[model samples]
Target: MSHPDTLIAEDLLLLLMDDEKGRLSASSQAQPLLGGALLVQLALDGAVEVEETNSRWRPAKVEARQVAGTDPDPLLAGAWETVAQKPRSAQDLVSRLGKGVREQLQDRLVAKGMLERRQTRVLGLFPSTVWPAADRQHEQQVRQRLQDCLVAGAAPDARTAALVALLAAVDQAHKVVDRGALSTGEVKRRAKAISEGAWAAKAVRDAVAASQAAITAAVMASTAATVSAGS
Candidate 1:
């Protein structure tokens, strides 16, 4: 891809970031979405594929498998190699993929003077951090592209379409766009078409489904953790 820095994960995070507030909006979904984005990126690079598994005892699970040679991008290569080391279910793999990944990516962007770090707390007690935009132009472009594709019905190339699919599957797409731009019905219709469109690979679809379950589980698990902590 000509724009290697234009990672789908970064775009999603950028769009989620509240520049004026210096906090990522809907912080709960950030890591799960980032994890999903990484997997989707690996799939798009042809370095990984996901296998479906249906079980009554658990949430949706899928196996991540390597597809080809080493990816030239170190971040991609590192994650690719980690997946190669073991066969992991989507939730387990996402846990690994997302652990500290936000910090790593943010550090890279910060080093380039593109992002700024700020600290806050969840529920006014749990300390948390946010990466606000040090440079807003690039992220604005990313958000605009998403708006054009989902609202205006413009055709996006593969990578972008994959980002939309991953975000939508996790029920986070609406968080990034201007709702007034398109009716809820139009938004859903367009997002579904892009996500399930011909440009999306079978592996991407499976990964997204698996990640959706993983995201739900993560949200529930974190909420439980918070409750248990309070108790």
Candidate 2:
């Protein structure tokens, strides 16, 4: 049987998507965030492990646990299979597992009545499909959790902590968070603290840390390429 509740990646995607625009925010960086959420989810479930690194230069490796039965969620099955194939670095797995995941996620959300898929033409020539909110209640509840954790300084549950860490990894926390009275910097600081907090096991923390590093490198590389092209 498939997992019943929405996956953590689904929640993260909903949070990152702009309901009005029917598009994702930080589109380029969203894949890694979703991938990281999956890894973190597995870690929380004790289905994957991040090998400890003794040297600063070495990247921690991720390995999937050998379970007796099939994976519960069809969405996670591919990722689990990928990890089970071999022990790989988290950064590599993030990019590899991320490919083509967005389309799958969008389809699932659309079927669940959380989103609507609209087909249109960009510039009245190029065909495009956009996913707008069919229901805002779910997304709003997630935002409330984010607001409580980041702005109200409330203690986050495991899933919420993982979501916050992933958002912070992609530098999307400030963008998605509601800053009622706090400054952007403050929100970022709290997010960073949660990302580094002792809210999860070592393996889970390592997975999150690696994802953060990967996102940082990706952002920097993109910046460099843009600068080079401009020059």
Candidate 3:
């Protein structure tokens, strides 16, 4: 199977980022989403498997197992190595696989000319880094794919389906898409449908479900931590 030059996670980062502000729209939730994207991509590439326990006593798990003729990408290879090291629940693997992914992916995109890295100081004191879009050609294509699927009622391919799932998982589908005459609710509903649609294999579906669950858990955990700190 042929894969896009950019990984799903890269595309997702682009989608979630505000091109002008150089900040992610849902910055706090990006980690789980990126990790989830990696898991689904690995499943799509036949580099990993999401095994279902189908029992109340046990949980779903992911195993690293590459197809005979396939060679995983370097970043993916590293994540695959982590998975190969042990069988873990998807939620456990989400944050683990996502660690350092954002920085690495940002640097990769910067080197590829898809984004520009800028240094700024907050209050003229604190140094900060921001990535703004340098090249929008690739991002436009990704948005177009989402447009076709969510607005035009087109059936999405595996990658597009996975992206829809990730965006919907974080409730960012309507925020990212133009929606034209469509209401935000309609766009989100369409996004939800595509996420749950029959466009991928069982393993891929399981991976998507795991990603959604992991994202929810991560968001709740972050919220709880913030509350605790404030209290």
Candidate 4:
């Protein structure tokens, strides 16, 4: 496969630093102090040229160093394991592993060439070649099922299940898109619409709330620990 044109952004580049098990992660955010839309547009257009900019955005490059330990998140490790085996849909992976882990895994994997993403229609039809034969077949099956379920306007439970299944297929296709494994954009386009369903919206909301709670607890615990130590 061809290397994806780098999309340089003013935002820091999230590099995937993998451990021995191929469980990927990023140690620190590589803040892009320069290049913004110019970089993104170049990447979107598949241009691989690297244009140098001012040093303001460039942080001192840290020498190559080894990580002595594994990532704190086991879900992240597991997600990499799944993606390494084959391209997967972000939607499907998220259904199994929560949205946070899924999104993190996608970011890491996409950086590491293990995953790709694209938007697709609700019916899951996209013209992308990144999919392996097996994954494409799976996508086709899920697409047909979703179409049938929607056409019949099945009971609420059945409709929900069908939609969920369809999302899973789309998630796998997204991995392909992120990796530049597919050339077509249809799957990505369709999946974007499907992802906005009622169930998905609720799931995203719950995940966000839980994440906020976790961060609050961590901050509180850290403050308590510091106070006790100082006293």
In order, the Cα lDDT scores of the candidates are 0.72, 0.83, 0.86, 0.30
Could you tell me every candidate's TM-score relative to the true structure? 0.80, 0.92, 0.95, 0.20
Q: Tens digits of per-residue lDDT for model 3 on 153-215?
A: 999988899999989988988877789999999999999899888998887787788878888
Off by over 4 Å in 4: 1-200
Clashes of each: 0, 0, 0, 30
- C-alpha-based local distance difference test score of model 1: 0.72
lDDT of 2 at 199: 92
* C-alpha lDDT of residue 72 in model 3: 49
Task: Give the alpha carbon lDDT tens digit for every residue of 50-93 in model 2.
Answer: 88779888887889986555557886887888989999988888
Winner of 2 and 4 under lDDT: 2
Residue clash pairs of candidate 1 = none
Candidates 1 and 4 compared: the better one by lDDT is: 1
Candidate 1 per-residue lDDT over residues 81-122, each given as its tens digit: 777786677777666777777777777777767788778998
Error of 2 at 112 (Å): 0.7
Distance from true location, Cα of 211 in model 1, Å:
2.4
Error (Å) of candidate 3 at residue 5 is 0.9
Write one digit per residue (lDDT tens) for candidate 4, span 1-231: 111222211111221222222222221111111111121222222221222334754421111112233332343234334434543322222233332332443454455453445443444775432211212333344445444333333322322332332222223323322323333354444443343334333433222222223323333555588789999
Note each model's CA RMSD in angstroms.
Answer: 3.7, 1.9, 1.5, 21.4
